[model samples]
Target: MQLKGIHHVSSLTADARRNVDFYTNVLGMRLVKKTVNQDDTSVYHLFYGDERGNPGTEVTFFEIPMAASNKRGTNSITKVSLRVPGDSALEYWKQRFEEHSVQHGDIQKQAGRLVLPFEDPEGHRMQFVSDEHDQGVEPGTPWEHSNASPANGATGLGPVRLTVKTAEPTAAVLKDIMGFSEIQSYPHPNDTDLPDIRVFETGKGGSGAEIHIETRSDLPAERQGRGAVHHVAFRVEDADELQQWIERIKNARLPNSGFVERYYFQSLYFREPNGILFELATDGPGFEGDEPFEHLGESLALPPFLEPSRSEIEARLKPID
Candidate 1:
């Protein structure tokens, strides 16, 4: 299977505006698109990433007002890392965190990259690292200096990194099925139980391996719950290869056997050994289906199946504003 890389990472949050504020304000990521969940219109489906909202850089969230406990174990989200410019940018982020009053762990290094770990408003473990990744999409830089008087600002989504249970079948899927070739490896640092951090890029050293996967800790496993990433999606070249990927998953003894087509592409969902859900998504019939890329997420989009309910669905949606 020749899968490209991540299409986007979807997770849960208690509120949309708070999540938006954290990404756009504190982190300096652009709200690429603002829209509502196709299925559950009541909740906003927010997209945050670089200028064009390219693959791998996009991290999505669902707003479920009822607060839930942050879950962390062997199968949950351990950490989410994004690659920024470098070590100097990290110092800027440190000052920014202090200014925003956002709590974060001390600066640290992992796999030869400088990382600054922090949590979102909802407790989602997220970090920004100073590693230069050339995402094919022209990356965006922050427009204004921070109010904290930092030398720099938090840049756009670097690379969305996820901690997996193990690097086995998931790693296999990445290399063999997904078409992500091994780039290199690095140690997880002294304090972490994580093993050597293996690197893989989407294609021909394609800019920031859209969906970069790494195991948080090799010691044991964890469980998924609130605040942890629910699933990550890898983009496929087209529908044919995507269909083939569905069979490949079953061949690997993965249990996802059905195809649920979203507006832009089709998807196959199955849980990896570590319990984090993995989504194989087709890259085409893109955001243009409802609106142009420049204007995407500006309004509600309906899947073909849900087109008939446009009025009723719009009516039922909660007032996110």
Candidate 2:
């Protein structure tokens, strides 16, 4: 069974509205789903993605006010990289970030591509990689709230960088279990402490097909909080393939959430040996499952089981915008 590519990267946010503004306005992604986190129901679970909120295109957040800042160290997702169409798009984003007063770094070459590094308002690490190698999504409907038009807008997610104390364990999970191939190694772009980063390729060996593992033997364990990535999900083809993975995970004796239904998609979650949480998610019954395509993210939506407590849940959450 092939783990397709990145389904979504979920993180924690301090303020839902601020997170929404940055992702929708500054980053030029569509707010595809607005719902409360099922586990808590007191906070918002916001989803941002491409025009249709396609599986690999999504980035979600759990609103957690008063949460501590992320402690960057080993066993954490250090950066979430989004794919932009080309060099022009990358330049447009660089200018857009500058005019908007968004903190960013110099556009530099990394892994044979141009990368523009930046952070969200809550300090969640983000980057835009120009996929000249044709590794990004093609332009479709334009993002309505921003000037980053379809031509230069973010296509979808690219590689996610995971920091770990040792690469072997995480490497094995990515390679053997997740259907990724150990591609190559590169010097850790920003960390002088890391000797080199291991790279893996899943689908086409570019953009969403990649995963970068940064080895830091000297770093401390990560403490998750706001701006920290809680988990990264990889997409599975459909229910049949998802079931296959459930069996594989169980047979391998890997600790995993046994085929949990997430409403939007069914998922199987497991932590890699180093502690980074990974999820295998199905692609169907997506963001449109509970809402129509046109009215997505317009109001709060709850999963079937939680509908009974909708009133109480709604009472607890502050309006996002």
Candidate 3:
């Protein structure tokens, strides 16, 4: 079965409250899920997305209060892209970022699309990509009640950029193992002197369903901490497809966490040859499974297994709002 598109990207943050404020109040994404990191119950795992926290729209964070600042380098998810309505929306966001004092670069064209690059308070690299001419997987609806107008609000995730020491091995895993098709290449936005960045896409490809790989022999392996992306997940249709993918990955002889029950979705985690973590996750049983849509993120939520220890988990997490 073909993968749909990006499921979500999970990153690190040191301060949960400030992180929530920036994503919800400034960026205007809805805090769709307020929960604890399943692997580490002591910390908060917050999810932000368009109105309903659709699969491809989510950007998540794990709170690590004492984590060091991320040291930028190769072998990392260097930048995350969020899709806005159109080129005009870029102008809207450029003005909004100014009003909110968000650090951003002037709108520029990258890989044939107009984009406005910006960073969150924690220095997480992100850009707002215009979907004026985008096709393929549909975008999610922006939250109506957020600070930004729904017309110009960020819709869903776009192409995720992976910076690696060398491109061949990582590209091989994407093309040969993961079924991504190499579509085209473009000059690296920051350095035209380096090798051109390669673009890859899967099912119903477009801005929403592509991966941009940047090969930089110049930088060292990344020192991941706060603001570093932990992993990027691609979307599979359902549990059955995920199970089939688990078998496929096993056949490919990659070491992986097979058949993980994430509650909201099933997942299989593995790393590409360059050591960048990749996850294949199902698209159903989403954020609304536990809480009513209107009240989502208003209270801390736990999966069925974690429900027994909710009291202890709640005691450990600092209030994010």
Highest-TM-score candidate:
3
What is the TM-score of candidate 2? 0.95
Please provide, for model 2 over 207-269, each residue's C-alpha lDDT reduced to its tens digit, 9 standing for 90 to 100: 886789888888899999889999999888898889899898888778888988889999899
lDDT of 2: 0.85
Residue range 126-173, candidate 3, lDDT tens digits: 999999899878999999898778889989999999999999998999
TM-score of 1: 0.79
Whole-model alpha-carbon lDDT for candidate 1: 0.65
Whose lDDT is greatest here? 3
Worst 10 residues of 1 by lDDT: 142-151
**How many clashing residue pairs appear in each of the predictions shown?**
8, 0, 0
Q: How close is each model in CA RMSD to the real structure?
A: 4.0, 1.7, 0.7
**Which residue ranges in model 3 land beyond 4 Å of their true spot?**
none
Rank candidates by lDDT, best first: 3, 2, 1
lDDT by residue (1-321, candidate 1, tens digit) is 555555677888887767766776677665656666766776667777655465556778877667576556555545566656667777877887898888888898665556789887777877876654443433344433333222344343444555666667667766675567777776665444556666776753443444455665543554444576767777777778877877777887866846877766678898766556778777666556666756655566666677786788778666544
